[model samples]
Target chain A: MKKVTAHDVARLAEVSQSAVSRAFTPGASVAPDTRERIEKAARKLGYRPNAIARSLITRRSRIIGLVMSYLENQFYPVVIERLCQALQRDGYHVLLFISQTEDADEVLTDILQYQVDGIVMASTTLSSALASDCQNAGIPVVLFNRVAQLGAMGAYSTSSVTSQNREGGRMVGELLLRTGHRRIAWLAGAEKTSTSRDREAGLCDALAAAGLALHARGVGNYDFAEARRAVHLLFRDPASRPDALFAANDHMAIAALETLRTELGLRVPHDVSVVGFDNVPQAAWPSFDLTTVQQNIDEMVDATRNLLFDQLGGQVMARSIDVPCVLMERGTVARRDDEPGRKPGRARQPA
Target chain B: MKKVTAHDVARLAEVSQSAVSRAFTPGASVAPDTRERIEKAARKLGYRPNAIARSLITRRSRIIGLVMSYLENQFYPVVIERLCQALQRDGYHVLLFISQTEDADEVLTDILQYQVDGIVMASTTLSSALASDCQNAGIPVVLFNRVAQLGAMGAYSTSSVTSQNREGGRMVGELLLRTGHRRIAWLAGAEKTSTSRDREAGLCDALAAAGLALHARGVGNYDFAEARRAVHLLFRDPASRPDALFAANDHMAIAALETLRTELGLRVPHDVSVVGFDNVPQAAWPSFDLTTVQQNIDEMVDATRNLLFDQLGGQVMARSIDVPCVLMERGTVARRDDEPGRKPGRARQPA
Candidate 1:
């Protein structure tokens, strides 16, 4: 089979080769009827404009380097699908780089080599050196669901889109309080992540406001097995066990729920209330019926898209946008006042 | 910061520009000592090779177009992460395209326009016309976890990698039968998907061998909400309720489990048993602890990577490789003989 060329389409469409090229080039000027004719001819001859060759002249690959980790988290899969679809609609393709480690440094070299027009780091951190390198190289970078530390970025900062983590955490804490859940426990994700830090801080703020402190804390590092281990450790001493457990994310919360129910044979809400951030799809399942903080995925993804395009379209300053989150009230949160036999301050039975 | 060029690197390393290019190209030969000096200079200058320009010269983009649909399913997230990591290790990058619809037709135009060296269709189907178009364009396409219809592809066939879905389904059927499940219902995914059709067929084959048939069937279209709807439909009438249910995949099975336990207030394995294919990570969660068929993901991925590379390395024949699947016995299945109060053929109480 002969390879279809621009010349063949040009000849068939009765247009110049340059005109055919212009017709295929996005945002290039060509008469509407002539462009239609060229497109018809190209389709008939099965001719596709070579994007690689075009990138050489335009210096735009139209590829966004998406650095992500922890696909196990249900939130990310939902975000990834929506983000990809949104970007694709804007005629941009995603060059996916799965960062095995927490930081994006390892994959930075490969990402830069691709000459992508922009980058979106989701659930992955970036170092000061790499952050500056991206800026110096004139590539736009956006951190999704995260924010860069002021000290980490130094003079060069990357654009970021994040939910109001601290505020969301406070909401969760307050909800637990309003439902008469004292002796609250906090479950943390990876220690280094700003998300975990902010959420914990928010919960602390809420506790401080009410003149109450965390009963206990456990670290899961945002992993399922680790979360299960943390749940065990948190519940080891039944006498001191928390009446309410708040995990940084739904993944950990789900794991905690499983351990509490299956392993310990403890009843949710009745015995202990549970809350989590990131209202992942699993949280809504009838089996779990988890109450969590809903990070507006649509609003977050849209903010990310805007941040990236703002830079790509020649906007100068790197900005950070935080979309507000909401609380999802579900069966998991039990109002202590409604329980006929149990008092708010009474000691609960051990699992 | 000024942009670093190959010439600058060559000058700094005391080598020719062509030599600098060879040092960066993946299989291009360069003296070890010279390459080391060139790399050192490139590092000093922060010069990364332009993959876009190289693609133009080599006519090999070193990019695989990964067309996937249904990221909601926990199984695909696992596959995507592993696939990306493996391909990156092999010096290939994945250009991700999310197919919004069931078919890959819409994304195919953008995929071809990118001139990716190869394509991997994961949970997406291709039409015959597009199959031949890819073949004529001299591009290799591989369907991961799926196979193509002979009639659809005409003379142009694409390679595929899949687990033994039929055998897996049969195994599930046999397991349920061994547990004394008399009325076994089958829940299906999308009706058009080969995965769903093949699994249903295999289930029927096992029932035929046992001198029985599917007591009832419902289609979920491999969606969570749809699976919930199907579960309600299957169990709506308690008199005709199946003693055992086999969902085509773990996602649907999880949904069915949630519905059965929470909505229908039925005891899993005591009143009815549930089984699913594709032992996703969620299925192993203590809350689900699903009894399902485990498609060896690592083996399947390895087969896909090998098949793709073989074709890219000049192998002509389109191969179909089916990795064997095994049954994972967790907590969901129950032995009917163990229940002293009930018989295998007794009617279940209505929800």
Candidate 2:
């Protein structure tokens, strides 16, 4: 069977071929009645306007490259689904690229070939050289959950959307301290990541304000298994076991909860109070009931979408947006002074 | 700066423009020395071959449309990441369309406009008319984790890759029976899904062979909150409570585990044993340690990749491949007679 074309649809609809093309092109000027007639004819003839051919003429693919290295962390899957839905409403599709390497250099090279109109980089990092390469190629890029130094030219000219990581970290630290926890331990994701580093810095800021230091620290590299192992070592010394533990993200925090409950035979908020960032859905599950900082994913995704479209609309600017974070006071954190069989006002505060 | 083109690369490499195109095209023929020269020229000129233009000439977009409705299940995110990486290795990119509607018709229509080389539908269903539309358009589609009937012409001529869901369900039933649990309950996913229905059918098959039937059943629609509610209703009547419960998928099963432990205060494997399908990474976490069926994702992904590429390579055929499932024995399932204060041989079997 021969393939249907716009010409056939135009002939069937008693309109010009260019009219049929304009009817199919998004944002093109076409009369409402004409477009309706053309669409009816095209539907009858099973004709689909070729996006590739139109892309060559219009210099727009209406495709966004969504680059990520992994999805083991549950947070990204939610963001991905929402981002695709949001972009779809604006007449664009997401071309997904999962980076095989730690950094996004290799995947970006492959994505550059696709001629995507824009890009959203998640769970990956871009080098200054490649960021400039994307800039030179006229592709707008929005970093999700990551930030880079502003180069002389606005740091490769890529925009970023992130939760206020350092502030969220400080919130967790203050919550832990306000409950009369003297010994607090920290669990970190990848040390190099801005999210991990900023959150840790905020926690340190809170601890410094109270004239206390972290009692212990361990790095999990943002992996479940690594978090479990780190939890083991951090709590191995019962004599010096921290009263409270704060993990960099909900994924690692969940892992710590599981390890503490099952492996160490410890009761949460009793033996140790724990906190995490990114209040993932799992944090609210009754079993975890974790106290965490909410990253406001909707706002983050919205900011990312706006940043990308603004650049695509010919604006030459680079900006960093920090969405505010709210701390979810759940059941995981407990008041140390209110221990069972003890008076409520006698817990020692850090000196 | 002027946009670098294939003409520039051809001129710099002292070769024909077609040779420069062939060097960039996967599987296109070009002399070894010519490709090297073209690569060197491309590198020097900072020229990346235009995939869109090449796609028009080759009649292949090298983009596979990956359609999914939701990523909450966790299983699908893993599949999406793996499939993207696998296709990337073969020079194919994934165009992701997250369906806002329950079915795939709308997203499928949008995908057709892109003229993608193929498609992979996950976590969504397709109607017969739309399936045939894809078949008629010569775009091969593979349904992941779902199966459909063989229509008069092989069920719209789309391929499917799935686990042995029915057999896996039967295995769960047999294990429960062997351990002396007569009162078995079932918590289902969406009743309309083949994965859910077939699994339940298989469980009934095992029960029928043993001259028994399910003690009770509940539908969670494969959602976390719904599963928690289903667990509440299923366990409301203490005197008639089931001894074993099987959930159609791990997401719901994890929710059930959390509800039973926290909300119901029921001990897993001690008061009531539990089993789940799909053995997602969360199933192995120490807090869960769920006994479930393992759907070998690697094998399923490999099969899907092969089936899709086969059709792309001009093989006209409809095929359904079922990767086998394995029972992952863990801490969730318990032998009835082995309960505390109960003699090992005292528990009665169905007979």
Candidate 3:
């Protein structure tokens, strides 16, 4: 026979579930007759409210606390949304904790009273001690986007899709060389992330193959304003301005285009060709028409969803998945033969 | 003196709060010395444990189950994001339970275990029985977006802010009548949502004021393909063809524009005028410089955030807030002198 839960007992007794809960709860009040009838119905139905019954035997809350930060980022939203949906699909109701300003200790304290099943930290820079605290209570934590110092615990690590960062950088380097560009400028995302480090290594590999090195480089912290500032620095010494600009991501590329168009009043491709990764919706806008590398969001999302399920279901999983990237050429670059503009010496000179 | 919380002990012990929980919990093990030291400190500090103690004395999970849905919509991500953040900030980690196109009873089983403190129905159409199930358990559910067939106990409702449809329709009606449009048509979203209803009603009011009625009308769901099909139906019989078209929302407007431009070879405002609402970023693109009503998303987000906080912090709040809208006139609407290129007798036919 299937488990006859409290809900079934409530139905059989014609009393509310809370009435049954009160009947089972010591010192909790229920009308005398209703309590007798509930007790009678419970015996007849073989109702096993063991999870609640266990509350008296072992005071476990069974609620899992989840902390997700950075909802504004398109990537985080979709990921968190999926995580929430999947967790809900499982038996666990997530108690959500969000930190707006990296308030780690406060976030940890906020959920302490509720006593959750476990905590899943999404987009956090939480210290190792916090993770220790959650697990120290015999609660396992799974970190998403952020890493934990302890490797034994579960963590859904996100790496770039496609040929790892080193290979991706090499592809860009080879493409630049084939197009006969010698001097290049590179704009990188925040130096803190492992992603930036790997991609940088790959780019160096490609540039080294062509017997050339990056002429100008700057870190943009993976944001538009920072990219704009970095680009401005590149232009300060016009003598070494790169022929082509390779930004870490599309947002930075769009910023470069905006600065070039409105500020410097330069026509794209003719003045400075730009390339970016992650072809966000705006990259295809009639204005920018940027060349980009696609990072298979569908595959990435699928992998994440599946991994989360595997983890939830107690299935062991490998540490990471490297999705591949493919170059998408739009209107951003120009061919050498077509480059006859104002300055003769300035013609197709790699920065 | 204020009661000392778990955080204070966790800080003093240099252990996580869950450690404090595990220490106090019988059969919930911690190192014996660690448990003794914590017990000593807590007693010395005159700190009483919180809800879990009461919950242990009684038999309650102290968890609030949440039933959430909706993912495809962009705003949903942000909504859930903030909801999760706020709920977490309020000391509740959402036990994410999601069921996609499956029997809800199957999902409810997961929630049955640690009978929750309350239930918050963020998204989904919960029938009366389900609502009662929650209410009877003394679970207060605050519904978001979806209405309660059973008079809802607590609800945060939305009022249409994107253009008072009737006013906007009337504005278009007056402009069309003044510019001499004898035939005007309506393209509408699904009849289910209140948004569609208000806009349609508003349109009818405007057209009636000008002594004009819709020459033809078609219905479509809020999707590009569906709207495209609805617009196609409007052109099936050319005899009742409209001189102008008003789409319920911007996506539908863009669909109509694309069809009119690519398939019908019609010039905007000259051959047919078009208007829409919710000026999404795509509407501002040079290719589709559509006239639209702007829904103040920022203000709406602010209001929603505050409302959620009010509810979380034991404060009652207003049922709903209507943000407001603005009509942006662009290249799509025609003027008096501009009608020279249109049909001769059709000049200035009201609405």
Predicted candidate 1 versus true structure: per-residue lDDT over A68-102, tens digit per residue: 99799989989889999999999999999999888
Candidate 3 docking classification: acceptable
Stretches of model 2 off by over 4 angstroms after superposition:
A11-15, A26-37, A149-157, A338-351, B11-16, B25-38, B149-157, B338-351
lDDT by residue (A1-351, candidate 2, tens digit) is: 356889999999999999988897679999999999999998898998888888888889999999987798889999999899899999999999998655888888888888899999997878888888888877888899998755666546578999999999999889888897868899999988999999999998898788778889999999999999999999999878888999999999999999999989999988999999888888888878999999999999999999998898885777889999999999988888665544322333467
Model 2: share of true interface contacts reproduced: 0.78
Task: Quote the lDDT for B223 in model 1.
Answer: 87
Query: How would you encode candidate 2's per-residue C-alpha lDDT over B1-351 as one tens digit per residue?
Result: 256899999999999998888888789999898899999999998998888888988789999999998799889899998898889888899999998654788888889889899999987778878888888888899998888645666557568999999999999999998997888899999988889998999898898787788889999999999999999999999987888999999999999999999889999988999999998888988778999999999899999999999988875787989999999999999888555544333323465
Q: What Cα-based lDDT does every candidate model obtain?
A: 0.88, 0.88, 0.62
How well does model 1 score by local distance difference test? 0.88
Model 3 residue B89 CA deviation (Å) reads 4.9
lDDT of 2 at A103: 80
Best by TM-score: 1
Return the TM-score for each candidate structure. 0.94, 0.93, 0.66
List, residue by residue over A242-314, the lDDT tens digit for candidate 3. Answer: 7778887776788788777666766777777788876765566445778877665556545555554454344
